[model samples]
Target: MKKILMVATNVDQIGDQQTGLWLSEFVEPATEWTHAGFEVTGASIKGGKIPIDPNSYSNELPRVWDGVMEPIHDTAKLTDINPDDYDAIFFCGGHGAMLDFPNNNEISALLDHFKQNEKLIGAICHGPAAFVGNKDVNDSSIVKGIKITGYSNEEEQGTGLAEAVPFLLEDELKEAGASYESGGPEAEHVVVDQNFITGQNPQSTHRIAEIFKEHLS
Candidate 1:
């Protein structure tokens, strides 16, 4: 069986408002992976309970909230996990990801390890924030020249958090040299380039998991 490390932000608030893991982004993919018999481990920057962005809660939660919340509620610290243990690593998104995913040396190092080993890597929505400053062995941004997609500036503006987020995800990825693409606002779009797979938003969650499984196979 393949193993996957799913990383979520511990940031429970963005300024005075609440923000954390986008519940559907994490839960939907996790449920799919679990049902497929993948061993999925959740980790956070600080470990412990990973907060969910209240705005992401939906009626669908009650149907899939059981087994999915365990790993999330008590995630391992990112520093404690060995990147070598998993076949792939997925960064879960939320507004909180913009606050903590970038500039995180631990995440950068783990991404480096996975890239060096030719292992799979994935992220969705604001989760691509983790790739902002991450670089390859050549010291070039890991996303440089790759086709990737994430939460769009339009979508951020729609949320009225264009200024609240640390940086616009689509813009940051482009700045890193990625050829950013999107399926417009809230449309499902998943980009698969080599070992890196990125989804555009929460709407792309299920498809991201499907593509990841395809690549794993």
Candidate 2:
């Protein structure tokens, strides 16, 4: 089975909006990958446990919650996870991710591993914020010349967190030299660049996972 690594934020606050990995983004996508028979591992900056945003999983989206089929392992064990051991790495998103993941060395190292080993790297929503600090082993921009997209600045403003959230996802990706594109601030947008696929928001979760499986399987 293909092995996959999932990285999420352990922080569960969003200036009182209640945040972490959006359930649909993490669960729906991982479910599709796991059911396809891949081995999935969950990691957070803190390791062992990660927080789930209560608002992300509502009765409005039952399939996503039900689809999440397994327990997540400690991410700190990822120090031993070679990119060669996993088919791809997925960074799930939520508003809280913007607060916790950007400056994390662990996340940056994982991205570096994928780049060096030529493995897939996937992310959704503000999860792309984790990419803000990932540099290629050679010290050049890693996502340079790479087509990508994530939660747009407009969406951030839409959420009324342009100031509350510390950084801007689209602006940071552009600053990093990624060839960014999106569904134009829409909720269900997804972008794929070879082994790197990104979902625009929680609504884009399942489709993003399907895109990942289609390539890996």
Candidate 3:
């Protein structure tokens, strides 16, 4: 079976607002991947209980998804995982990712490993924040000159946290030289550029999984 490392942020706060992993962004794809027989491992920057964006859930957690929530509630430390052990690495999105994913040495190193080994790499929504300051083995920006998509400035503004986020994902991707595109606000948009796959927002999770499974096959 193929192994996939699903990385999420440990950050649970963004300013005075509540933020963490966008529940659907992580759970939806993970459920699909698991059903497809992939050994999906949930991990975070810091090993422990992963935080869920309060806005992504309601008054009660869904019991139907309890199995999927297990690893998320107790994730492994991203730094402790060996990139070589997985066929791919997927960065799940949330506002918190903008705060923690970029400039992370471990994440950069993981991206480098995946690139050098020709392994698959993916990110969704704000998850692309992981690529902001990351470079490949050649020292060029990993996203430089690639076709990619992520949470747009429009979507950020829609949440009314445009000013709160450290940086806008769409602008950062373009500034890094990526040919960024969007399927309008809150629409399903997935971009595949060689071994890299990116999704525009939470709405794109299911399609991202389908495309990712196709790539793995």
Superposed on all Cα atoms, the candidates' RMSDs to the truth, in angstroms, are 1.2, 2.2, 1.2
Tell me the tens digit of each residue's lDDT in model 2 across 1-217: 8888887777778775767767667777777887899988877766666677776655476654463534443454445656667778988888878887776666777788887777889999988888886676686666888899899988888888788787788999999899988787666777877668888877788788888898888
TM-score for every candidate vs. truth?
0.96, 0.90, 0.96
Clashes of 2: 0
Model 2 spans > 4 angstroms off: 59-69, 73-77
Q: Write the per-residue lDDT of candidate 1 for residues 25-120, one digit (tens) a residue.
A: 888888888888899999998999999888998656676658887899899998899887899999999999998898778988898889889899
Off by over 4 Å in 1: none
lDDT for residue 210 in candidate 1, whole number 0-100: 97
> What lDDT score is found at residue 151 in candidate 2?
93
Which pairs clash in model 2? none
Backbone clashes in candidate 1 total 0
Question: lDDT score, residue 88, model 1?
Answer: 95
